[model samples]
Target: MPTIPSLSGLRGRNTRQPAVGRIPVPMSAYVVDCAVYVDGKRLPRRFTHADAIAEVRERGEGFVWIGLFEPDDEQIQGIAETFGLHELAVEDAVCAHQRPKLERYDETLFMVLKTVRYIEHESPTTANEIVETGEIMAFLGRDFVVTVRHGQHSGLHGLRGELEADPERLCSGPAAVLHAIADRIVDSYLAVTDAIEEDIDEIESMVFAPNSPIGAEHIYLMKREVLELRRSVTPLANPLRRLAEGYSPLVPDQVRSYFRDVDDHLTTVSERVGSFDELLTTLVDATLAKITLQQSTDMRKITSWAAIVAVPTMVVGVYGMNFDFMPELHWRFGYPLVMAMILVACLILYRTFRRNRWL
Candidate 1:
């Protein structure tokens, strides 16, 4: 095996110092971490993208893994050039919001995965957002794996540490890194799905409760969130399936089985997400039905009251005409008799309405 260059020697040769008056911007601003791994153990010294790949290729026994966070096109251009990443894939990685997918560009496999986090709130009925989404795009090569993240919560620092802790797994090469990333992403899906299920359950109970304050709008909001989740999750299924079935040479047979496991977990998440969407739809219908029933009940009560008032209104209207030959107008007990009749009629109507549960 060829001896790798010392870190100081490589840095001195490759790194350009800035002008004295100008403040230098380090690569760490966008390059989260860059390292070379030999036999699954991370090299102790840090390296730039160019240096890391050079070291890996020169040694011919290790691979380079580089991670970046929200890098612009200019910032990523050098790495793109160094790795021979396709232009389209580079563009998608720079300007994210691409759907979850897997594409092949010569010897490289580019895969995009959506990351989701559940926003916590007191109640689903009152929360404005239930699920928050992010993106992770991975470029897999025979001896290099590059990850670009596009959201605040989509950090992979912990994942890097976890992989480093398990050298046996990491030694499997760049495919191992790709598999770990996919596995971690699907595990996130599982967690977010569990949290969403709880929210759905809470909303379901509130929707069915007697005199519930829950509205269709709240359910609609949740449904909208679930729809967002679905969009992020559903499209990746085919990509994972293809990887499991060996769609790319970059992913070896061992990694393909792991991809299959990730695919199975993804399938579970997809099914749960689908069920959440359907349940939210049902809740919306139930909410609307309850609203309609409440409106109908209110109208019945209003109509019943109007009927009770009509009797006195009609009697008083006749007396108010001041006609000369109105019946009982001059009778000795006419006023009391009219009062009794009005009271009796109102009582009968009230009792009938009460009996019918319309009062």
Candidate 2:
């Protein structure tokens, strides 16, 4: 085994710390190899190709975890060939835009998972900002475990750190690594749900106070954001549902408990996303209803005022007629009488409107 090199700083640290004894280091920006456990002791560098393959061929035990970061197609193909994985799985691994999914090929299992980290400060939902979506396509066959991802994912990093801290679980076998990965992905879903719940609270407030200037852009943005999140995360249900049903051979009997828990978490997440869609729909309806009510109120007020003024104008029009035979036209009190009549009519109409609560 090679001497573990010292790392200046590890990510996800609130405070800095000095290097310790033997530390497993990342091979490149694209790959990390770790020797899980050997001979009842956790080695600094766990296993290689020969060691990993020999264990399955010989002792029928042990596990190897190879984390791939932003790997090219050639490297992916090479990994597939090395591990005896299917060509279709390798093709899917190289593809960037696949939704969360899973497949079984011979003795191997290919699982594509999505892990999201919410940018709460930047936007309302995971869709509004660039989330750290982890494309964790793992090959869990025999004694080897390979996880390929597109970029640096905090959930993956955290899982690896946790397994390193407790070598017993990771060293237990390949199943342990699969368990850790599943657990971490589920945790990420919970985190995203928290952020979405906060957005729901904001939407609730807006629903009650519909007059408070929530622009069209905001509604459009909210609708689009939730839809994007729904699209990205929903496909995962297929894979998880399959796993929960014990469809994958790579998933052990003991690990099924964890997978079941993950299934529950996924169900919760799906419910939340559905609720968010309903909330947005309600908001749109409420906004439109408020606008319509305001318009109707304004029109009623205009009609009421027009009726009040029409009474006085008609009285004046009759008195101003040029007919010589008109009695009120020649009378000394005619103008005053006509003016009083007009005043009485307006007063009566105004009082009637007020009584009817139409003023």
Q: Which candidate has the top score in TM-score?
A: 1
Each candidate: RMSD to true structure? 11.4, 12.5
Candidate 2, residue 341: how far the Cα is off, in Å: 8.6
lDDT of 2 by residue, 1-359 (tens): 98664465544555656778764343454566545454334556446655656655675455667777666666566567778989888888777567888888999988887667666564342244533455677888867788877655533666777777786766556767776787777777777777767766776676577367654456667777677777757888778777767886677777677777878887887888888888788778877787787788888778888899999888768766777888777789988988888899999989888787668
Cα displacement (angstroms), candidate 1, residue 147, comes to 0.5
> lDDT of candidate 1 vs native?
0.91
Q: Can you write out model 1's per-residue Cα lDDT over 18-66, one digit (the tens) per residue?
A: 8678455567899999999998899999798999999998998889999
Candidate 1: stretches off by over 4 Å: 1-25
lDDT value, candidate 2, whole model:
0.71
The TM-scores of all predictions, comma-separated, are 0.92, 0.71
